[model samples]
Target: MDYSPHPTTAPSPPPATGSVSGKAVRPGDRIFLGLSRGSGIALLVIMAAIAAFLTYRSVLAISGDKSNFFTTLDWNAVGTEPKFGIAVLAFGTLVSSVVAMLIAVPVAVGIALFISHYAPRRLASPLGYVIDLLAAVPSIVYGLWGALFLVPHLSGLYGWLNDFLGWTGIFSYSNGAARSLFTVGILLAIMILPIVTSVSREVFLQVPRMHEEAALALGATRWEVIRMSVLPFGRSGVISASMLGLGRALGETMAVATVLSPSFLINASLLDPGGGTFAQNIASKFSEADTFGQDALIASGLVLFVITLLVNGAARLIIARRKEYSGASA
Candidate 1:
């Protein structure tokens, strides 16, 4: 569908009328407007192309599959009977991301508020810079750190969780190396923290100073001021920041591959060395996979891509819903 906005025909300014507007079509204006409209059209074309490619490859791979594409537990789409599913991969991806959100969002919000509102004026800038620097560190470095240093140090804590929360089954650790969903979530949390904090900090910082002053004049305590004046204003910003972090967590590949032990089964034990995310699975399997296997991987990538699109769409709706009231940008 050609939904890109078309350039509207606007009458020339009254002072410039009676010229048939031919002479009024300034070359500079024509070039600029044409370029802008063309860019929009180009973007639409690119998006369409990507969707078409994913759909083609995914259909080719799944056409011969015998198993329920959504329910099957294993990925074996390259065999004579070609059976595969994204259930396990999707589950792990969501679980790890959920864990990351659970751990990261609160901490990120707190740090953001601290940097924007609580930190000394002189220290705030430097602290924020440090956080931004953390975000700049390449994902592979995080992967290496997670594998080489974090894995060994996590076994004891995993054992403790198993001992104390084993009855719940969810936290039950299998005494395996700490390459599990929880560990992956922790690494993801660290990796995403800087970005989330940076976004939230900017949002909170943009809250109208008058609002804060009004709250103070009304004798609101610091905590109460934030609760009543700051938080309400930045709620959308915080949501946006969290969504960005979730996006990063979802697409993270190298870090996840390095920190997780891949498997096809889904289990309740979050501290065990098993389960696989979409990105992790694709990266780990693609090079060694046959042609059909590659197609199957592309199918999984399509799913991830769709998931990302849905997440972003939802975030946009959420932000739009609250735009009228959020004073974070005021």
Candidate 2:
């Protein structure tokens, strides 16, 4: 008689994964997936198309240059032996952007911190609203105001800087009108301030209540709590905000054109009036330039495009490096 216990059969293999079993996706999910993928592909295609166009135009312009396209300081793009270069443009753009960042970032952080952590709710809400409103103000308005009101009023401050810091060469001035790269930087800083402050304030407001409470429980002071918990969590966000502000300062055309007294010559001192930015140059010259001259401007535009990409790339790297401490990772 077969009385022995039947040999235990091995457990059935686990049900096939979603892929093997062809688990059905919801219609809504499938639609969303397709849309998102299509959007991403479209963005890449558009970017590639723009890059190709810029490259082709730039090659034609550079091929026609009579001098070193990157090093020459002349910008006579008219006659048969035409010459122009971006050396001064590059210098002015970088210097002005750097100065704007230096002036705007710390002030923006302070304003954000005050709004987020220190101000009474009554004051904070209205103040934040005002800052947001400032952001909505047009860049051209800022440019006009800068050129008319701000520049005239800045002479005294420029003189003060020259008196105290002229030996540094950067602050040295020719005692002329205050239409200089430094002034352009100041205008850019003002234009970008609302953006940085708004973004930073939002980030600071998003700090975990529990983390702040824990710091309080440990008898930490307000500043100490912020330094340890809030700042760490919001560092990446602040960086992103700064990068956004920088991008605005970089590609600003109307504002720069309206404010800057553009020239092809590079001045050693930011307080000097002789310098130009790519955006400023393009905006100021594009209308008057001939076909080949317009192509030259496009070449400069290509350089500006490359610069903006590099700035964004660097900002991404910075955010990624600090992701561990940022709430983004959490």
Candidate 3:
């Protein structure tokens, strides 16, 4: 009985609670969170600063007493009046970009498909590396190549197009040389091709292996399996890649400027040697431009910025929609 009474021991204390939900974060975690927030804020501030600067410069051009700021096709920034408008610039930009996309998209997708689905593993990696290298090459180099080499060789192609498609008007070429919108487009396509192909190939490779295997097990042909499993999954990615290429095509300055001879007129012919783009005009005239002329160029740049933003935004929306549809189907 004495032993039993001595056996009674003290009970253990209850566990300490830091918060109501019983969750505790260390000092390191809090510091990391603060750093992340700071980084985000800094990015936003930088973006805002850039936007403000561009807006300030552009307003000077837009609000100046220049005649026909939006309609005139002239780009004589050094002239006394310094009259100019985005009409020709916009046309050239759109024409070159559209042509580039037309040439690049198909080739890019095909190359991507071949690399992801058809090429041997060793060959695919090397080829992909080469494409990436192409993407990394400087724009100025492309410009020089276009100016010195590509333009000379394109005369034959231009002649063929003019001869066969002259009645269509779009391919009509009055100039004997190949330095035209079409040639610029072709050069742009070559420059942007690597980018589009690399993006597309990466996307296609992300397709689920199980889905591809399932299609194969169901006795589908290789092409059929790809059509069902790969292309569908990568459709959004392909669009995104194409849009990236389009952005590059649209904003390219040195290449277009070096290759294109700008005349202030909007023509329907893709073969026309006369047209300009905002970037090209800026690059061509910015150095010799006066204060007001610089402002005008900045204004054109502002317009280009807006256009690029709109295009990228539209592309994001399309990709988002495609993702939603894919999720629904799954």
Can you write out model 3's per-residue Cα lDDT over 157-245, one digit (the tens) per residue? 87888899989999887756677888899999999999999989988987878999999999999999989999989988899889988
lDDT (tens digit, per residue) of candidate 2 on 93-168:
9999999999999999999999999999889999999999999999999999998998889889889999999999
Q: Which stretches of candidate 3 lie over 4 Å from their true place?
A: 1-36, 77-80, 320-330
Q: Local error of candidate 3 at 162, Å?
A: 1.4
TM of each candidate vs. truth? 0.89, 0.85, 0.85
When sorted by lDDT, best at the front, the candidate numbers are 2, 1, 3
Candidates 1 and 2 compared: the better one by TM-score is 1
Model 2 / residue 318 / CA error / Å: 4.4
Q: Candidate 2: worst 10 consecutive residues by lDDT? A: 1-10
How much is the lDDT of residue 73 in candidate 2? 90
The lowest-lDDT stretch of 10 consecutive residues in candidate 1 is 1-10
TM-score, prediction 1: 0.89
Ranked candidates (TM-score, high to low): 1, 3, 2
Structure candidate 1, residue pairs in collision:
none
Pick the TM-score winner. Answer: 1
Q: Report lDDT (CA) for all predictions.
A: 0.89, 0.89, 0.86
Task: Please estimate how well model 3 matches the true structure, expressed as its whole-model Cα lDDT.
Answer: 0.86
